[model samples]
Target: PIEVVGLLNDLYTLYDAILRNYDVYKVETIGDTYMVASGLPQRNGSRHAAEIAYMALDILSSVGDFRVRHAPSVPIHIRIGLHSGPCMAGAVGVTRYCLFGDTVNTASRMESTGLPYRIHMSRSTVQALLSLDEGYKIDVRGQTELKGKDVEETYWLVGKAGFPRPLPTPLHIKPV
Candidate 1:
C-alpha cells in the first residue's frame, strides 16, 4: 500500500501548506477526502467564503503537479465543493470538533455531485465571493438536485477574474 501512503503524504503536505496561508481550519480528512471551513469559532464574516474559494483553487493547482509514486504517469485530480451559510460547531464525544446543520450537508452534496479537478460552489458562496471582491470567475452549473435539499443553482469556480482565459495549463510532471 505504498502508493496509498505516498499519495496521502503528498496530499497532507499540500493541505498543510494551504492551511499556513489561509485562515481556514481543517474540519477532517477521511481517506482521500478533506474538509475545511472558515468563519467558525472566530466568525470573519464574508471573508470565509473568499478564503475557502481561493484555497480550493490553490489545492486544484497543486494537485495538477502531483504524481502517484506508483503511477507517475497519471495526474492526481481532486473535486472540491463549497457552501456559505451558518452552522453550529462544537466538540463531539471527547475531543472531536464537529459541524452540524444544513450548510454542512449542502456542501457535502456539492462535492459528491461535482466533477473531478473542479470546484463546485453553492449560490451563497458565489454571492459571498462577489461581495468580497476577490476577483474570482465562476461558471454557472445550473440547477442540480441535492440530497435533503431541493434543487439548487450551482457554479464552478473558474479562476481569478480578469486573468487570461482558459487559465494556465496545470503543471504536470513527466512520467517516470
Candidate 2:
C-alpha cells in the first residue's frame, strides 16, 4: 500500500534546514538514498570541498549525540564523500539544463562506498582539506581506484571541531 507522504514532514523539515545552511550541491532522493554535494556551480578552488566535508562530519556527530540524548529509539547515520578536480560544468538540454563532469561521477562513487557516519574523499580533496586553517583528524586510507580515473588515493575524515593536527595513523603493523 502507498504510504502517507506527510509522515516524513518533520524529517524533511530538518533535512532541508541542513541542506540550505551548508554548501549543498544537487540532492537526489531515491527512497532513503540521500545524495548531496558541494564545490559545484560555484567552485572555490579546493577550500569548498574541505568545508563541505567538514560540515558533513559535524552534522553527523551532532545528529548522533542528539539521538542518544533525546530519541534513543531512532538512530541515524550519514555517509558522505568529497572530491576535487577539473570537471566540465555545463547546462545540458534547453528546458532542463543540468551539470555533468568526471568530478561529479567520482564524488558519487566515493559516497557509495563510504562507511556510515564517515566522510570519504579523493586524494586531491584530502590534500585540499589538509591545507585549510582548521584542524582535522584525517586518516590516509591509501590509494584506491576511483571511477573514471586511472588511479586515485582516498582519505577518511576522522574528526573535526577539535584537535590541533590529525592524530597519527592508528594501525598495528608487524614485519611482513
Candidate 3:
C-alpha cells in the first residue's frame, strides 16, 4: 500500500505553497490521486486559465525535478487538466463554502486524460485568455472531444515569458 499519510502531507504542503503565490481553488486527495485547481471563487477576468496553467506547469516541473534529484528510483510525474467556464460557487454548509459546476468536471477530465506535466485546455478557455490579453503564446493541439462537452479545441500552453507573436504571424501550439 502507498504511504497515504506522507502523500497527504506532501500534497497539502505543496498545495499551500502554490496558493501563496497564485490562486488555488481546492486540493483533494483520494488515495494517491491529487487534484488542484486555480481561478475560482473570483475570476480575475481572463487570467484564470493562464494563472492556473502557470501554476500547474511550475508545480509539475518542481515535483518532477524533486523526484529525479532525491528519489531517482521512483519516477514521479503528474498529469494536469484545466478548463474555464461558468460555475456557481457558494457556501452551502455552515462550516465552509464549496464550489460546484460543469467546469469542475471538465477540468478534472482535462487533467485525468492529459499527459504528464501537460496542461490540457479547452478552446473556450483559450479564447477567454485571449480576450483578456493576447500576450500569452499558445499552440493549437487540434480539437478534442471532452468527456462531458461535445467537443472543444485544445491547446498546450508553451509559455508567457516570451513576447506575444506578431498579429500577422500565425501561432502553432504543440503537445507538451
Each candidate's lDDT (Cα)? 0.82, 0.63, 0.63
Candidate 1: give the clashing pairs: none
Q: After superposition, how far is residue 102 of candidate 1 from its true place, in Å?
A: 1.1
Estimate, for each residue in 18-137, the C-alpha lDDT of model 1 and write its tens digit.
788898988888888788999876788668998888778777777777777788998776778899898889998886888989998989999988877778899999998988786888
Using all chains and alpha carbons, the TM-scores for the candidates as numbered come to 0.87, 0.68, 0.75
Worst 10 residues of 1 by lDDT: 167-176
Better of 2 and 3 by TM-score: 3
Best by lDDT: 1
TM-score of 1: 0.87
Which of the predicted structures, 1 or 2, would earn the higher TM-score when compared with the native? 1
RMSD (Cα, Å) of candidate 2? 6.0
Q: Model 2 residue 16 lDDT?
A: 62
Candidate 3's TM-score reads: 0.75
Residue pairs clashing, model 2:
none
**Candidate 3 or 2, higher lDDT:** 3
